[model samples]
Target: METLFRICFFMAMMRFSAAEELKRNLNGVVGGNVTFPDPVLELGFLLGGRGTIALVNDRKLQIVEEIYTNKLNWNRNSGLFTITDLQKNDSGVYKVDSKKARVFYISYNLTVYDGAPTPAVETLTVSSDSCWLLCSVDKATSLLWYKDQEVQNQNSSASSLPITVHKEDRDSSYRCVAANPAENKTLHVNVRTACGFNETESGDNPKQRAYWSVIPAAIALIIGALVVWRVKRRLSEKRQTEDYAEVQINNENPQDGTFATSAESSDHFDSTVYSKLKLPEVTSAEPDLQATPT
Candidate 1:
């Protein structure tokens, strides 16, 4: 009878080993579809009998036996375990025990990542050495600057991992990719910014602050040239008046109303009677100088 009982126990042990022989394979954590990856993937183990399946990561062990809330549980004689809605945080090795004569172990690694940030927008109208660049991304993990598919650098103005970006490269069509490293989640973003002013091609490019300098110089030069011209014109007019006076004082005769060769004849001539002359009336300190030529 004892031998028979031992034989029955051995048979039971063999059956249990055969049922749990399906070896577990580690899932790829980097890339591939995780069907319903929104929730972290649940990993359970086969306890064989009425035992339990559990996982240990960072010294924390989470057991699975009953369908408790968001976790998957198992019943007696169950050999399959599950993981749900997995993220990068769910990475680590999980252990399972059948409480019998078999213990299975598998290692799983999780990864997560994010895309770049979105760029701001504005209006700019300019050309030449100055080109416009743009940047825009939403919920992105990393931002890589590029020009014609060539990865550029982020400059000193920013404080992100992607270092070296230029201020002048703003109006460009920027791209961003967001991802969850643990869940292998990924997304794309496109951004744009208005082009700004560029002085690279102007024929007479001048300093912006010096624009006011030319204005004062032009005004002063114009005023000085005008004063010099007025003085010269007055001098010419005086010389011409003196020449005409000398001729009149040398010869003229108003009595015959004709030119003469002697100064005495010019002295007796009436200057006011020749030209259409009108003189101002006398004042207290001024005389009416319109008397006869003599």
Candidate 2:
């Protein structure tokens, strides 16, 4: 009875070892290459079960299956398998067995997806107080929302999620993670202060406010320069007119030892005018005759 129990126990151990399944998950692009991990070679160790020769998908390596005829490659030293130009139809369970022991050495479950789509964020609605944003993808098994690289929503499991943006969150950055069992994609959105918010009443960041202030500041500087130039021009013209009036007054008063030449007054005269004055003339001989007679 003891010997029988030992044989039963050995058979149970064998059954348990045969029932063990090794799970491996892998992803590949539509037309990309994928390789299965190779089992480590130990000096005296056998993987999955004791074996001498390796068999793939229950077929001898020498006799390649039709599905893997030209697409499969194997490395003898590493015990690794590579498939080139992966197709959607090639996604399934791959098994490697030991020919001598007739037990599985390793099994791999591979799932191939077409490709991960690029995620995009869109603005749906905007109000004075808040804004609504949406992140979408063509197809996804789950969706994740992030704000500033931290997870925001953990319960979202759809292709799209609506994100609420408050006035205080103007400068916050949002991200979306769309994923499936095969692949995942991430997209980001930067929220600016001008997204339907009241920018004049304290909704902008320092940089944005400074940027907007530059426009008015530049306009003010230009206007000030124009005003200064106009005032200077007016003053210069007034000074020139005053000088001209002083010159005319000097010219009109002949008693002042200043005289205006015809060349200088030609520009101001419509036509030339003439003035006459007379003075008495005396002889010195009358005084000498009177003194000699006296």
Candidate 3:
């Protein structure tokens, strides 16, 4: 009797092992789809903690649950079942049973998660020769920073990760990744722009900044030259005016308009008039002297 009891216990353990062997695991993200393995002579499909959700009769699929009417699909040609637009609440153990000569069962453990959010990068601090960056995200299981193709830093449980880059690598490509078991999102970073040493800065591309800096100096030089030219022009004009004045003074006639030349006097003789005054002199003195003598 003890041997028979041991034999029964061994058979039960084997059965448990067989059942465990039929179980599979699956993962899906929100707004994504998952497909189950094909089944032959499928009888019914069940969800753990719930009643039957679907059945197959005469090779035709029929969904008994109204909740899965639009979300579930069964392919008759391939005998495959697919679920679309999965949600977090849809994660559970799913079972499908079939009957050929005897009953066969397969179960899938499905896990649905929210899609990982896209990572956001921020410049935390910047030194003269190095820069610190932070990568942050939500609803993600892991965050990582990559410089080129190499991993620079990573965190599995944290939502944020930090990394430092040198000035020499400012132009190198970098990416931030936020990931879950089901999906991942990546953000590309322009290292030069993110580190505040972009092409517009004099330190990064000296030619570009130099090109702009030279404009003001060039403009100033042009203005200075213009001012000098204007001053020289004014001085030249003043000198010319002085020389013209000297020439005019040296060549000006001395005679007034009232004074007539010989030609004019001859032409206007008829219209000319003259006046003169004379005084008596020696005859009066002689008469006085003679009177004295007499």
Each candidate's clash count = 48, 0, 0
Candidates ranked by TM-score: 3, 2, 1
List TM-score per model, in order: 0.28, 0.58, 0.64
- Per-residue error (Å), model 1, residue 49: 20
- For residues 1-294, write the lDDT of model 2, one tens digit per residue: 999999999998787576556566777767777877843322212222123222344222443355556776666567566777889887776655444444444666767787766778888987777888887777755787888868877434566777787877766777788776666788777666325564533534465777888999999999999999999999989766644422222356565445553223334557544332222445456444445454
Q: Note the Cα lDDT for every prediction shown.
A: 0.41, 0.63, 0.76
Off by over 4 Å in 3: 1-20, 39-51, 97-105, 199-231, 234-242, 245-294
Index of the highest-lDDT prediction: 3
Q: Could you tell which candidate, 1 or 3, scores higher by lDDT?
A: 3
lDDT (10s digit) by residue, model 1, range 1-294 = 999999999998887676555343345343222321111123333232334445433333466555423644333233344555444444444435433343333233323222223343222333444433433333434444555466564432232323222335444444422223323222222222233233342333355435557789999999999999999999989766544432232133454444432222233346633332223445467677798977
Task: Tell me the deviation in Å of residue 150 in model 2.
Answer: 3.2
